[model samples]
Target chain A: MTNETETEQTPEHVPMMQQILDNPFLLLFLGVTIPTVLYILWGVMEVASIPLAD
Target chain B: MTAETVVGVGRRAAAADFRTCPYTGLKVDAAAQTLIKANAVAAVVFLLIGGLMGLLVALTRWPAVHLLPADWFYLVLTGHGANVLLFWIIFFEIAVLYFASAVLLNCRLPAPKFAWLGFALMVVGAIITNVVVLQGESSVMFTSYPPMMAKPNFYLGLILFAVGALIGCAIFFATLAIAKQERTYEGSIPLVTFGALTAAIIAVFTIASGAIILIPTWLWSLGLIGEIDPLMYKVVWWAMGHSSQQINVSAHVSIWYMVGALLLGAKPLSEKVSRTAFFLYILFLQLASAHHLLAEPGLTASWKIVNTSYMMYLAVLGSMIHGLTVPGSIEAAQRKNGYDKGVFEWLRKAPWGNPAFAGMFLSLVMFGFIGGISGVVLGTEQLNVLMHNTIYVPGHFHGTVVTGTTLAFMAGTYLVLPLIFQREIVWPKLAKIQPYLFGIGAAGISLFMMGAGTLGVARRHWDITFSDAELSFAHSAGAFLMMGLNGVFAILAALGGAIYVLVVVGTVLFGKKITAGHKLTFPLHAGGGAAVSQYGSHATTKLPGTIVLVAIFFVCFVLYYFINWKYLSELWLFR
Candidate 1:
């Protein structure tokens, strides 16, 4: 029963790349800003990228 | 009683003033007990303040019902971190240092006046810091990284507190030397005292680092100095910041063994092994501070990789050794008492009703499983980016510092009230349940916050929802659920903390007094010196039940470790 539960929890054969792209931020970082420093607050998009109150 | 009386007399004659605990057979100095009481009372007051601030912070993080305004939330967060992390824990540690040296070794406290001076400075500093934070405008969180500055008084308050703690450490060392000259215990010092000594040494290093960074920053805040480099500030500051928690680790691990000895008549499975682990902590543990700077740009990849990978694992090894031997010792003792049926019959029969045992055992398990495993994960260079500056960071520390250290300290206090204060515990039923309530609730808060952080919620943001931001980001349904649940558990933990405060305060003020030489009718088991052995002649050495538990822990650790690696790998296509 324990072995079966372990097997069930482990991811079965979905492509790892597909899993990575599920988070939109990672996809944006890899596709657009791979060479640049990926600082969201330093002006990629207009407005405060970070929720930090100045 | 008088200063002249204590000063002129030979050290052996000073023993005339000491009274022996009838239960534990350890001599207690009256001055040490008074200092312990004062520090403990102060520690609980700060816990109440910090715990209330924590509840408000938790509620504000809950997206569906954000409680505090952004300004108020930041202010409270600053107060919460300072009081709980710095003031509460350090005050209690000074008390522990005195107890381990003077009381356990059965000697007079050298320079009682210096101890009182340290206590007065600490009390004044804690009050000043709190007052300045509440006065509004110093919302720079615990890491008051300048470019952003708090009031000059905020910096001054911290410096004063550190100097006071340094004095306490000096007194602890002097007492140890006096104990040696006076010939208190034979062979080496007790393992608990050795652990405390390790903490004191680390604290001195930590306090010096703080003084180096904070003094210049204080001048900058006063506009007497020009510029404070942010990177330079962070590098020096975490030497104190991270090592402060390391102090907690040593002290609480000592208490783990103490509670075990008190409750189960346990001994360290091997005193040499246990002492060696503490030695490793002294040598390599503070190197783990480099993990805080891993994602910073100023440091090189080689520096980060070496510090986080090789040297950091040595520190990890020290903790892992402690994790195994502490419970293993208890299991070995129980088996000797003839509970050696199945793998866990000894564990099953162990005293669940004793609040001290229950709190310490729960602290050990939660710390190992939640704090230890998560700490190793977050320290990894590649994996840290995913959780860095997220609620996961707070989640991880609350596991270590709150559930682990604070819970263990609370457990130690249960023994202290009866043992030192000569007072019976008030509301015995509430005291018994307090650990479970706090531990379980704290565990929930940790797990749920980590869950939210995994789903990419920000830390230190007043609102997780991006409600005030121009670009509003929507978090996953799971993140919302996790945060809402975190709020619920925070309330539960606060209730548990309230029970502790009420019980401790009521008992200290008005409970029935047990005269120091008499036996108690409460939770602490009535056991003499044989019951509190750190080593033994009995050789029934197998700890199969503890071995099984250790195996289960390793399984959980391995699975969680790999899962984080997989998460990191997904963040980059090549790496």
Candidate 2:
């Protein structure tokens, strides 16, 4: 994934997400993060729907 | 080179490459290092989440500060149990397996890709389970008992995790085989690796039991199966549940020895005796699962007696042997280094400033004194009935799992960061004090919980005050005080845990890196090579200090064991 030609051709700074994706450890974090965010959203929705008892 | 030769060449190149620790001179394969890092990182993350949940649970139990609502209390309790008990520990155990097998044996990992697959499955499964638990439909509180059902994904997630762990176990075995075939080290494996081998073997049995039970539970959750017998489910489930802690006992005991060696350059006092103890664990440890089912009416007395008395004693004997030999080994090593004055001189001369040594020694003492002794008492059929579903059960496990296993893992991480990751530990001052802070707080938590349990605090109930119940019951005021103190100690322990996390994460992310072949400047493990595996000569160099400690342990164990019996006797007098 580390390409010498590509680096030489594009000598500008890369985006932060691209840098994170390049690192395997950071990718592992991302793998867990997506599902966690979705789960949190789902949890918020579920709790919102619960009606208060009289 | 051709494509075939290119692949072959890469394989050969990686296999030929190894890095030797400048301090210990042990060879570490690159791929094994990757797996260890991945697993250890995941373990610490779970520890953070679990510790937070535990703090909430403790505060909720406090009478003066009933924190979370009942629903949230049960939910957080369930998450705490799953993350800390299963996820945090097993992830670290996988790391330990890789380190003990491939790194210790000086062999390359046989299937690095397959190992990654296992890691991915485990990560996915753990996330799935956490997600489901947070969804609030799966707060069955770790046990997920038959009559109370959780989402099917909860059971499915657990099954996937178990299968992933089974794959990791298989890789450990295969790595061992590769070491043997390649003749990496002569004779039998090292004692620490042997201990890890015991844990892995027990893991195989434990995971098999989990699969056997969780598979059906998954089906039942999906409505594919009829009613599951609650008693039958409990019997088989504990075979998975309690036996999993048996895996923890084996792994952390192994870490005790490993950290002893890394810190003090200590060897097992008698390598043969220690290895035999590990062997004893593999043979009889799973039978200790009977303690969880001791109060179940469905199980026959004969069955209970055989497991708790006949076989479980052997498991306890195994732990007793480890309790003696680990500190005995440290004392023997210290004496050999000419600290040969009085009984406590070797102990006094030990490198207590080193966090690794301090954490390990505290773990050993607390584990043997409180955890081991209380565990045996709680395991007894007669005494167990008094405190079966009470707060005492969690008290006993917190002593073992948190104080014993988690502390050992934390101690092991100190050395691991410097040695394996080649990072100079940041926050050295805080690192030095972290162990004691954690140890004192965790010990306080355990003692107060046990005290509360003794005064009739219910285990799973969120409110100690029976304000909502029709038939109200009142516990002693001391129990409320104990719960309050438990909350304070839990906060202290969480602070300690946070300090550890900051020190480790900060060091790994930004600390000075040691180049390959450069000697590490860390003062941990500053002793000479004279103590590394010093076997067969001056084996028993007058460890009166360890003898006294062991004697103290036994005396305390006897007192506690009988006190429980006395309490049981007072319940119904024949007079």
Candidate 3:
């Protein structure tokens, strides 16, 4: 039974190389740039200043 | 699919040898496998002991209910808290160190013998300490705050363990040096390895402080030295304790990123943002330890104000930044899925059913809301008088440490186990359930504990309200709530923990072998592929990105220390 299930769900070895190439900008913005900016903001900001602002 | 089915699929793709890589000297040897297995086993044993100790302490405080004999209760509580929080966690940290340095770095350990020696020393120290405490001779609380001394062995045992840990840290550094000299990889260290390296840096400072404080305490215990200044020792001790806590925090944040990436096929919300947060921790975490001593005497008002108001603000900002980035990464991942639009669309469409993801998410939220809030409040010099040394402090940490950090580690372990060990987990079903049960139970305990803490309930005691019975009826109500909730939570968490233990045990011992080269399938949202390009272009460039970040942090460190030094000179010396 286990063998049947194993054979049934063989993982597709889809190389992400092409997708990465297609949308390079979106990838860069989400993965690298944003985190970098956030880090700068965090270093500068004072915690007591952030209002609940709800 | 069941373990059997997974194994079958893996068998077809299995590399000729699962234990070794021909190209790289990474992966465990058959003998090394035994050591790694032993480390994991020891970690779980300590976890159970710690959990039980927590239970005793929690039960005793719940409405002042004394389950154990009053005489022996405090002793058990102290041992339990120290062993669980420090010993168990450090043991796990060593396991993580091994994984990051060797397994993740794709290199063999430089000195396996020293690594084993470190483990042995730590174990011997822990055993001696536990034995002494259980014999009812050493009742000093977790901090074993001097002036209230424990038996000689207890302090000696602690110092030995810390020394062993220092050796372990040394081995980690040695391993990294070898990797660099050998040019283990063409480009930068992997992100997980980078995070672990940062943690190792923090541990260096942490253990140095520990040696300074503990060695002196050891001498004092043996009558070999005159009185160590209690106030100075307090300051130095917290330098170790609090900074060590930050190491856990930084490590957990890294694990959070890993868990999200591995489980959900998510990219960091932003690599730069996450890396920046990691750097901020190195800058701000050490200074913030002074917040713990706000209510203590002999510190000038200006010192307390600067430490509490300025430094804690930076630390809080670091946490808040992470608070935003962690969720933002998840949201970006969900957005990639193109889920239906709603106010809570991201929350609704999230893979809530995946225990690993859910557990990680909840842990982050609880840490931010409960732990972070309590931390800010308690760190206030004025507020410290109300909450210092109270149940609230422990509650805050439990929320952060147990929920935020340990849960993430456990979740990551479940995901990584099959890949690391090359053995199928014994009970996949139980593995899935364990995180939620433990997280929920822990969160419940934290909530009750915080409530009690707000009432100025003292921690590190069997019965909270001493003599005068300053606790109001409402306070008593909160205590009962804490006790009852924690009791239920403890059982649930233990049950879940037991299942995890069984799964780990079975995998190491009785579980069937799996074929090598088995790749775990991570579901990709549309944006998942985007991260590959992002990381490849920015982070994967050949200049050692992590080392560059560390260097940048050191520059900031110099500036920070210079400023603090000037301030200290003016306040203490010139004044």
The per-prediction CA RMSD against the true structure, in angstroms, equals 14.0, 14.0, 13.6
Where does candidate 2 stray beyond 4 Å? A1-54, B1-16, B516-538
Q: Write the per-residue lDDT of candidate 3 for residues B50-104, one digit (tens) a residue.
A: 7777777666655445677676678778877777677877777777766666554
What is the two-chain DockQ of model 2?
A: 0.01
Tens-digit lDDT string for candidate 1 (B275-334):
778766776676677788878865666666666678678878989999989988889878
> What is the clash count for each candidate, in the order shown?
0, 0, 6
lDDT of 2 by residue, B1-575 (tens): 00000001122335556877777666678889989999999999999999999999999998888999999999999999999999999999999999988877777888988998998889989999999999997899989897999999999889989988989988998887777667665445666777788788778777877887799989999989987767666766776798788888888898888877767677778766786687667667777777787776556676677767787888899899988899898888777777879889889888887888888889988888878888898889998878778887788888898899999999989878987788988888999999999998899898898888888888989898888999989888898899999999999999999999899899889978877665554453544222332222226746789889889888898898888889999995788
TM-score of chain B of each: 0.96, 0.95, 0.82
Best by lDDT: 1
Query: Which consecutive 10 residues in model 3 chain B have the weakest lDDT in total?
Result: B1-10
TM-score of chain A of each: 0.33, 0.40, 0.32
- lDDT score of residue B179 within candidate 2: 72
Please say which candidate is ahead in TM-score: 1 or 2.
Answer: 1
TM-score of chain B of 3: 0.82
Best by TM-score: 1
What's the C-alpha lDDT at position B531 in model 3? 35
lDDT of 3 at B400: 76
TM-score of each: 0.88, 0.88, 0.76
Off by over 4 Å in 3: A1-54, B1-36, B337-350, B464-479, B517-575
